[model samples]
Target: MTGLLPELSPGLVLAGAVTAAAASLWLLLPRSGESRAARWLGLALGAAALAGLVATGRRLGGLGEEAVFLTVALVAVISGAATIVTRSPVYSAIWFALSLTGVSGVLLVLGAQFLGVATIVVYAGAILVMFLFVLMLAQPSGLAPYDRVSNEPLLSAVAGAVLLGLLSLAIGRLTSDTACCAVAPRAAGPATQAAAPAPSAVDPLAADQVARLGGELFGRHLLAVEVAGVLLLVALIGAIAAVARGEAALEDDRRLAAGGGRR
Candidate 1:
């Protein structure tokens, strides 16, 4: 128990700090009656705290890798926090879009170029546009009541802290284990089988990543692909129905006003 204390202390501290920072930001977020300065202060403090948390992790990688990681990470963190704290629903949605862009950038850094581009095209382009259209059509006048105030801020902060703590512990343990495995010397052993030849980059079968991806998606995950298509179609139909309903309501109001004036 005494030896275990040393290992647990850092994680406990990180969890505590994250929880405090998250709670503070949540408490200070702009409610309908809150002042602007408090919101701004909270945003700044939250950003600083997040930066500190990332710095403490001290992720091991090349200089270029580290730079790219920090750049996209900061963008994702700051914009994500802003999305939650912003007063205007439209601005919040825009911030959320920026956060998604940062996530796509991270994916690119991690060597998933196809997935990154797909994320941008599908999420940032198509899905975000649909979201904005729905938001506009739903609340043409101004912010809705739900948007004006956050529900269960304390509970949300606690939940976020727990997730962050778990993520940090997982990353720390994985990195430490990787470092240990990398540095530890391997024992001499007899060869079991002949090694396979490495594939060449210029090889036709190996080069076309898109073709490989398509084969995997259609071959292995065809049901998931079909389900996704069905979901998109359902969402499109729902959006159309919602817009039609709003227009019908407006037309009815206009007709009633005209009838009252005539009477």
Candidate 2:
């Protein structure tokens, strides 16, 4: 067993540790009738697990970039986990919004300024507002059976662990391949022998990025872009319809209650 343990790769070890932590946290989580002590224990376990996961990552890029990345990534991860564990739908939605904001911050740190801004505007601003609106309209008293009880916690933990393991394996393989490519000797070829054309220099933070992005979207992926826009329109229409139906139902219920009271 000792020899077998030593033979296990670091990626596998990390994945196992993460999976165990996740499962432990899931088991410790507060059920419908669980004590406060259990909830506290779950929170502690979750925090430790999150810390361990963050510590496993290799920091890349400049000091500032790494710092920002870590901070935002931490926020995103913690809030995302909170969103899943929280009993209150309102709080869950709020946590989700915070996670979105953290993702936007991470995107900005990664030099995707436009994507960061769009994420903030579309997800945190618009989508979050819509979600909150729906939640308020649907559950004015904030009590729901689905919100109180999680569905299949053990199963979710197992699924999440498997997904994380696959992701870690892919990342490790990609990193190893990149390092090998970087250090491996390159044979001189005909392309190398020929005078290579001087590459055009473009500013990394150029203002015309949006224009270039628009050109690419409209030129090469116009159909996909249109489809996405159409999907968004459909979603908006559905949401409006749902809200209208809910309001009408509530009004009818109120009228019936009023008639009953008079009788």
Candidate 3:
């Protein structure tokens, strides 16, 4: 079917460029400045997203079946890779954000604005901010201990490869080799009256596309959404517990000073 082929527009080019640039800057910064591994991973993922945007633009004339397939492949590869290759808690967090953003861009290209916005808002904005906050607060002691994590680099590599394989399979299956299903005859009428609608002003909440998203998550993917909420709750509790423990330890020292006759 041909109906799924998306119209290519100059706007796609601009969006691609902007996204690519943002991701590149995020990835390229030095660790001395902001964790090297994280920066490179973020940069690599950003590059991948840009590549997807470019591929999407090229396919804009209509991502014929083959183009759609290739586009999805690029996305799966990049996002999966980003998830695995990033080290450093903060860097991993940023790469995770990049992957989420990349998925959103792919959805946008496919005309799924609602899904795209949800991915970006939930994953990139809220979830990521939570993670970054945790990492910053932890200020992990001892670079030597952190460096020892590399001992499991092989395990990380294997896990990443498996993730990539699964993502590739999932995307490949979702896309058809044939162009999107064709538009029905009656649906093609009223070409003249089909003027393009004017764009609206940007709204922060509008970017979340909340209504469409609320319905989908609560209606179709109810179980998945609930599970995610539970996971988030667990993470929040754990974080609070950790901070409390650190503060309690500090308080013990203050009491020791006050009661121990400090000069």
Candidate 4:
């Protein structure tokens, strides 16, 4: 599998291998009941995530421009996985926020600065806080509930096959055209020397990609983004109402108890 990896960056290769091993171990961890083994696995996954981040940072040479992109990707992968495997809802939410931030960082690296910022603002700043607030307000005064959802083997198998097929198709599409390939060399200018130097020369298809993305997003996908906003607003409203109701109910109960009303 070492030979199968690309020669672009060794950090990415190491990250991928560590990610795969962590995921496999995570899958094998017990789901239903509390397992000491699962807790240890989570710790191991977190360690691997830190290692991946360090490796990526080193490859990108510290906190340089490229380092930001790779760092975010590494952090997102690790945090996202940690969110699921952790037992505490609050901790999970924190990890999820970190993961979303990482994703936004990746988008920023891809030249989608606006989208990346929006992603972080919406997911981490707003939605994540709402989730944390709700959990704190609604948490029952008892042990946390743990109910493992079982999957049907046949259905799971079918789903896995479909996912694999779709992934293969996606890979094929991505590698199909030369335009979608790696960044191209910059065009030389009249006054420029023999070596045209540009640190971030735009990719050949960058303009086209941006145009297409804007067209689709502002045209066909416009409704989807709008709908997402509305959904988030509704969720926020619902959370507020739930919290208010809970507080009111608690007040009423307190009043009743103070009055010594008994059957």
Tens digit per residue, CA lDDT, model 4, 1-263: 22333464644545453454445434533355546675666566556545543443323333576667666787887787667555567878999988998899888777776678889888888878989899999876654655133344235434543564455446546755657753334443444433545423543235566566778788988999999999989998998999999999999999989888663
> Deviation in angstroms for 115 in model 2?
1.1
In candidate 3, what are the lDDT values of residues 1-263, reduced to their tens digit? 22232564434443444455444534442223356576667667567545544443323344474476466646654665555444455666676777676677667655577777878888788878977887788767644345324434434444544564455445544554334322223323356225423121112234446576687679999999989999989998998999999999999999998989865
Per-residue lDDT of candidate 1, residues 1-263 (tens digit): 12333554666656655865676567666565777677667667676566447645564357887888888978987798778777788898899989988998988776666787899899889988988998887875766677778777767777877788788788778866855534322221223111323211112233466677788799999999999999989998998999999999999999999999999
Per-candidate alpha-carbon RMSD to the true structure: 7.0, 6.3, 11.8, 8.7
Deviating ranges (above 4 Å) for candidate 2: 1-9, 28-30, 140-142, 179-207, 233-263
What TM-scores do the predictions have?
A: 0.70, 0.73, 0.42, 0.52
**Which candidate wins on lDDT?**
2
lDDT, model 4: 0.63
What's the ranking of the predictions by TM-score, best on top?
Answer: 2, 1, 4, 3
lDDT of 2 by residue, 1-263 (tens): 12334665566557655776667557654356767777776677676566556655775646886788899998998888878777788998999989998999887776677898999898888879988998888885756777666777777777887788778778867776855534322333456434433211223335577787778789999999999999989998998999999999999999999999999
The 10 consecutive residues of candidate 1 with the worst lDDT sum are: 192-201
What TM-score does candidate 2 get on C-alpha atoms? 0.73
The list of candidate 3 runs beyond 4 A from truth reads 1-76, 141-144, 159-263
Q: Which candidate number maximizes TM-score? A: 2
Report how far residue 163 has shifted in candidate 1, in Å.
2.8
Off by over 4 Å in 4: 1-66, 147-169, 176-263
